[model samples]
Target: MTSLERVSISIEKRLLTRLEKLIKSSRYTNRSEFIRDMIRSKLVEQDWANERREVIGTITLIYDHHRRELSEKLTDIQHDHHDEVLASTHVHIAHDRCAEMIMVKGRVDRVRALADRLHREKGVLHAELSMSATGDSLR
Candidate 1:
Protein backbone atom coordinates (compact mmCIF):
# COMPACT_ATOMS: atom_id res chain seq x y z
CA MET A 1 0.00 0.00 0.00
CA THR A 2 1.14 3.55 -0.69
CA SER A 3 1.72 5.83 2.24
CA LEU A 4 -0.32 9.00 2.57
CA GLU A 5 1.32 12.36 3.00
CA ARG A 6 -0.02 15.13 5.18
CA VAL A 7 0.10 18.54 3.58
CA SER A 8 -1.34 22.03 3.86
CA ILE A 9 -2.68 24.45 1.26
CA SER A 10 -3.71 28.07 1.30
CA ILE A 11 -6.67 29.43 -0.65
CA GLU A 12 -8.68 32.64 -0.74
CA LYS A 13 -11.78 32.72 1.44
CA ARG A 14 -14.16 32.95 -1.51
CA LEU A 15 -12.58 30.00 -3.25
CA LEU A 16 -12.72 27.92 -0.08
CA THR A 17 -16.42 28.60 0.35
CA ARG A 18 -17.05 27.67 -3.27
CA LEU A 19 -15.08 24.48 -2.81
CA GLU A 20 -17.07 23.57 0.27
CA LYS A 21 -20.35 24.14 -1.51
CA LEU A 22 -19.24 22.07 -4.47
CA ILE A 23 -18.19 19.25 -2.16
CA LYS A 24 -21.46 19.28 -0.26
CA SER A 25 -23.57 19.31 -3.41
CA SER A 26 -21.50 16.50 -4.85
CA ARG A 27 -22.11 14.47 -1.66
CA TYR A 28 -18.50 14.00 -0.72
CA THR A 29 -17.98 13.42 3.01
CA ASN A 30 -14.56 14.99 3.20
CA ARG A 31 -12.40 17.54 1.38
CA SER A 32 -9.36 15.26 0.99
CA GLU A 33 -11.20 12.58 -0.96
CA PHE A 34 -12.91 15.08 -3.21
CA ILE A 35 -9.63 16.83 -3.88
CA ARG A 36 -7.97 13.52 -4.68
CA ASP A 37 -10.66 12.62 -7.22
CA MET A 38 -10.46 16.07 -8.79
CA ILE A 39 -6.71 15.63 -9.17
CA ARG A 40 -7.19 12.20 -10.74
CA SER A 41 -9.75 13.56 -13.18
CA LYS A 42 -7.25 16.24 -14.21
CA LEU A 43 -4.63 13.53 -14.71
CA VAL A 44 -6.97 11.62 -17.02
CA GLU A 45 -7.45 14.78 -19.09
CA GLN A 46 -3.70 15.23 -19.24
CA ASP A 47 -3.26 11.68 -20.49
CA TRP A 48 -5.69 12.28 -23.34
CA ALA A 49 -4.02 15.60 -24.19
CA ASN A 50 -0.77 13.78 -24.90
CA GLU A 51 -1.47 12.19 -28.28
CA ARG A 52 0.73 9.14 -27.79
CA ARG A 53 -0.78 8.08 -24.45
CA GLU A 54 -2.75 4.81 -24.41
CA VAL A 55 -6.21 5.78 -23.24
CA ILE A 56 -9.72 4.36 -23.20
CA GLY A 57 -13.05 6.01 -24.06
CA THR A 58 -16.51 5.51 -25.47
CA ILE A 59 -17.98 6.89 -28.68
CA THR A 60 -21.73 7.28 -28.47
CA LEU A 61 -23.75 7.92 -31.60
CA ILE A 62 -27.41 8.61 -32.31
CA TYR A 63 -28.55 8.25 -35.87
CA ASP A 64 -31.42 7.44 -38.18
CA HIS A 65 -31.54 3.72 -38.79
CA HIS A 66 -33.23 4.19 -42.16
CA ARG A 67 -30.44 6.28 -43.63
CA ARG A 68 -28.79 4.72 -46.65
CA GLU A 69 -25.40 3.08 -46.04
CA LEU A 70 -24.80 4.74 -42.67
CA SER A 71 -24.59 1.58 -40.64
CA GLU A 72 -22.24 0.02 -43.15
CA LYS A 73 -20.07 3.12 -43.25
CA LEU A 74 -19.79 3.24 -39.46
CA THR A 75 -18.97 -0.45 -39.46
CA ASP A 76 -16.22 0.10 -41.98
CA ILE A 77 -14.70 2.84 -39.86
CA GLN A 78 -14.71 0.60 -36.80
CA HIS A 79 -13.18 -2.23 -38.81
CA ASP A 80 -10.45 0.12 -39.96
CA HIS A 81 -9.62 0.79 -36.32
CA HIS A 82 -10.24 -2.75 -35.13
CA ASP A 83 -7.20 -2.66 -32.88
CA GLU A 84 -8.69 0.26 -30.89
CA VAL A 85 -12.25 -1.03 -30.67
CA LEU A 86 -12.89 -3.20 -27.68
CA ALA A 87 -16.62 -3.67 -28.21
CA SER A 88 -19.70 -1.92 -29.52
CA THR A 89 -23.38 -2.15 -28.67
CA HIS A 90 -26.25 -1.04 -30.89
CA VAL A 91 -29.88 -0.63 -29.90
CA HIS A 92 -33.02 0.68 -31.43
CA ILE A 93 -33.93 3.94 -29.74
CA ALA A 94 -37.15 4.19 -31.73
CA HIS A 95 -38.74 2.82 -34.88
CA ASP A 96 -36.59 5.05 -37.07
CA ARG A 97 -33.61 5.90 -34.86
CA CYS A 98 -30.75 3.92 -33.33
CA ALA A 99 -27.98 4.44 -30.81
CA GLU A 100 -24.49 2.97 -30.74
CA MET A 101 -21.97 2.93 -27.88
CA ILE A 102 -18.50 1.81 -28.79
CA MET A 103 -15.78 1.19 -26.18
CA VAL A 104 -12.27 1.78 -27.46
CA LYS A 105 -8.76 1.66 -26.01
CA GLY A 106 -5.78 2.99 -27.93
CA ARG A 107 -3.59 6.01 -28.66
CA VAL A 108 -5.37 9.35 -28.29
CA ASP A 109 -4.95 10.39 -31.94
CA ARG A 110 -6.38 7.18 -33.37
CA VAL A 111 -9.33 7.23 -30.99
CA ARG A 112 -10.13 10.88 -31.79
CA ALA A 113 -9.83 10.10 -35.49
CA LEU A 114 -12.31 7.26 -35.14
CA ALA A 115 -14.80 9.55 -33.38
CA ASP A 116 -14.37 12.25 -36.05
CA ARG A 117 -14.91 9.75 -38.85
CA LEU A 118 -18.08 8.41 -37.25
CA HIS A 119 -19.35 11.91 -36.50
CA ARG A 120 -18.82 13.21 -40.04
CA GLU A 121 -21.00 10.55 -41.65
CA LYS A 122 -24.12 11.98 -43.32
CA GLY A 123 -26.82 10.55 -41.06
CA VAL A 124 -25.42 10.69 -37.55
CA LEU A 125 -27.65 12.99 -35.54
CA HIS A 126 -25.38 13.18 -32.52
CA ALA A 127 -21.92 11.93 -31.67
CA GLU A 128 -19.91 12.31 -28.46
CA LEU A 129 -16.57 10.95 -27.37
CA SER A 130 -16.28 10.45 -23.61
CA MET A 131 -12.61 10.27 -22.78
CA SER A 132 -11.23 8.04 -20.01
CA ALA A 133 -8.21 6.07 -18.88
CA THR A 134 -7.08 2.46 -18.35
CA GLY A 135 -6.64 3.04 -14.53
CA ASP A 136 -2.94 2.28 -14.39
CA SER A 137 -2.08 5.96 -14.19
CA LEU A 138 -4.82 6.69 -11.68
CA ARG A 139 -3.49 4.11 -9.26
Candidate 2:
Protein backbone atom coordinates (compact mmCIF):
# COMPACT_ATOMS: atom_id res chain seq x y z
CA MET A 1 0.00 0.00 0.00
CA THR A 2 1.11 3.56 -0.65
CA SER A 3 1.83 5.92 2.23
CA LEU A 4 -0.83 8.49 3.08
CA GLU A 5 -0.14 12.20 3.49
CA ARG A 6 -2.42 14.78 4.99
CA VAL A 7 -2.51 18.28 3.57
CA SER A 8 -4.65 21.31 4.27
CA ILE A 9 -5.74 24.24 2.12
CA SER A 10 -7.88 27.27 2.74
CA ILE A 11 -11.01 27.86 0.71
CA GLU A 12 -13.85 30.39 0.77
CA LYS A 13 -16.79 29.52 3.01
CA ARG A 14 -19.21 29.25 0.09
CA LEU A 15 -17.01 26.77 -1.79
CA LEU A 16 -16.49 24.68 1.31
CA THR A 17 -20.23 24.46 1.85
CA ARG A 18 -20.71 23.40 -1.75
CA LEU A 19 -17.96 20.80 -1.38
CA GLU A 20 -19.67 19.33 1.66
CA LYS A 21 -22.94 19.14 -0.21
CA LEU A 22 -21.25 17.41 -3.12
CA ILE A 23 -19.62 14.93 -0.77
CA LYS A 24 -22.95 14.06 0.82
CA SER A 25 -24.72 13.72 -2.53
CA SER A 26 -21.94 11.52 -3.89
CA ARG A 27 -22.24 9.20 -0.85
CA TYR A 28 -18.61 9.67 0.08
CA THR A 29 -17.73 9.21 3.74
CA ASN A 30 -15.42 12.24 3.79
CA ARG A 31 -14.02 15.08 1.73
CA SER A 32 -10.54 13.63 1.18
CA GLU A 33 -11.75 10.59 -0.76
CA PHE A 34 -13.97 12.74 -2.93
CA ILE A 35 -11.17 15.15 -3.72
CA ARG A 36 -8.81 12.29 -4.57
CA ASP A 37 -11.27 10.87 -7.11
CA MET A 38 -11.83 14.32 -8.63
CA ILE A 39 -8.09 14.68 -9.05
CA ARG A 40 -7.85 11.24 -10.68
CA SER A 41 -10.60 12.17 -13.15
CA LYS A 42 -8.63 15.24 -14.14
CA LEU A 43 -5.54 13.11 -14.64
CA VAL A 44 -7.39 10.85 -17.06
CA GLU A 45 -8.52 13.92 -19.01
CA GLN A 46 -4.94 15.13 -19.18
CA ASP A 47 -3.74 11.74 -20.44
CA TRP A 48 -6.16 11.88 -23.36
CA ALA A 49 -5.04 15.40 -24.19
CA ASN A 50 -1.52 14.11 -24.85
CA GLU A 51 -1.65 12.95 -28.47
CA ARG A 52 1.20 10.43 -28.22
CA ARG A 53 -0.12 8.76 -25.09
CA GLU A 54 -1.60 5.28 -25.45
CA VAL A 55 -5.17 5.20 -24.12
CA ILE A 56 -7.96 2.65 -23.99
CA GLY A 57 -11.59 3.45 -24.70
CA THR A 58 -14.82 2.11 -26.13
CA ILE A 59 -16.91 3.26 -29.05
CA THR A 60 -20.62 2.59 -28.89
CA LEU A 61 -22.72 2.87 -32.04
CA ILE A 62 -26.40 2.48 -32.78
CA TYR A 63 -27.50 2.25 -36.35
CA ASP A 64 -29.93 0.83 -38.86
CA HIS A 65 -28.94 -2.61 -40.09
CA HIS A 66 -31.12 -2.24 -43.15
CA ARG A 67 -28.94 0.47 -44.60
CA ARG A 68 -27.21 -0.81 -47.74
CA GLU A 69 -23.59 -1.86 -47.28
CA LEU A 70 -23.33 -0.06 -43.92
CA SER A 71 -22.26 -3.13 -41.99
CA GLU A 72 -19.68 -4.01 -44.59
CA LYS A 73 -18.30 -0.51 -44.57
CA LEU A 74 -18.00 -0.49 -40.80
CA THR A 75 -16.27 -3.86 -40.87
CA ASP A 76 -13.83 -2.62 -43.48
CA ILE A 77 -12.99 0.39 -41.39
CA GLN A 78 -12.34 -1.77 -38.36
CA HIS A 79 -10.21 -4.11 -40.40
CA ASP A 80 -8.24 -1.15 -41.65
CA HIS A 81 -7.39 -0.38 -38.03
CA HIS A 82 -7.12 -3.99 -36.87
CA ASP A 83 -4.18 -3.24 -34.63
CA GLU A 84 -6.23 -0.90 -32.49
CA VAL A 85 -9.56 -2.74 -32.31
CA LEU A 86 -9.35 -5.25 -29.50
CA ALA A 87 -12.83 -6.67 -29.67
CA SER A 88 -16.36 -5.85 -30.78
CA THR A 89 -19.85 -7.04 -29.91
CA HIS A 90 -23.00 -6.57 -31.93
CA VAL A 91 -26.57 -6.74 -30.70
CA HIS A 92 -29.83 -6.68 -32.58
CA ILE A 93 -31.93 -3.99 -30.96
CA ALA A 94 -35.05 -4.28 -33.10
CA HIS A 95 -36.07 -5.71 -36.44
CA ASP A 96 -34.07 -3.07 -38.21
CA ARG A 97 -31.90 -1.46 -35.56
CA CYS A 98 -28.60 -2.71 -34.18
CA ALA A 99 -26.11 -1.66 -31.55
CA GLU A 100 -22.39 -2.31 -31.40
CA MET A 101 -19.71 -1.69 -28.84
CA ILE A 102 -16.08 -1.69 -29.91
CA MET A 103 -13.15 -1.84 -27.55
CA VAL A 104 -10.16 0.08 -28.87
CA LYS A 105 -6.67 0.84 -27.59
CA GLY A 106 -4.07 3.04 -29.27
CA ARG A 107 -2.75 6.56 -29.49
CA VAL A 108 -5.36 9.27 -28.78
CA ASP A 109 -5.38 10.50 -32.37
CA ARG A 110 -6.00 7.09 -33.95
CA VAL A 111 -8.80 6.22 -31.55
CA ARG A 112 -10.43 9.59 -32.11
CA ALA A 113 -10.16 9.10 -35.85
CA LEU A 114 -11.79 5.68 -35.62
CA ALA A 115 -14.64 7.14 -33.59
CA ASP A 116 -15.06 10.02 -36.03
CA ARG A 117 -15.15 7.67 -39.00
CA LEU A 118 -17.87 5.60 -37.37
CA HIS A 119 -19.80 8.71 -36.35
CA ARG A 120 -19.79 10.18 -39.85
CA GLU A 121 -21.20 7.09 -41.52
CA LYS A 122 -24.62 7.71 -43.11
CA GLY A 123 -26.69 5.12 -41.25
CA VAL A 124 -25.25 5.55 -37.78
CA LEU A 125 -27.93 7.05 -35.52
CA HIS A 126 -25.65 7.53 -32.56
CA ALA A 127 -21.96 7.20 -31.72
CA GLU A 128 -20.19 7.81 -28.44
CA LEU A 129 -16.52 7.50 -27.45
CA SER A 130 -15.81 6.78 -23.80
CA MET A 131 -12.22 7.78 -23.01
CA SER A 132 -10.32 5.86 -20.38
CA ALA A 133 -6.79 5.30 -19.14
CA THR A 134 -4.53 2.35 -19.83
CA GLY A 135 -3.95 2.17 -16.04
CA ASP A 136 -0.21 2.70 -16.47
CA SER A 137 -0.21 6.10 -14.80
CA LEU A 138 -3.19 5.68 -12.48
CA ARG A 139 -1.12 3.86 -9.88
Index of the highest-TM-score prediction: 1
TM-score of each: 0.96, 0.93
**1-139 per-residue lDDT for model 2 (tens digits):** 9998999999999999999999999999978889999988888999999989999999999999999999999999999999889999999999999999999999999999999999999999999999899988787
Q: What is the C-alpha lDDT of each candidate?
A: 0.97, 0.94
- Model 2: how large is the Cα RMSD against the reference? 1.2
Misplaced by over 4 Å in model 2 are none
Clash count in backbone of candidate 2: 0
Residue 38 lDDT, candidate 2, scale 0-100 = 91
Candidate 1 lDDT tens digits, 1-33: 999999999999999999999999999999999
The TM-score between candidate 1 and the true structure equals: 0.96
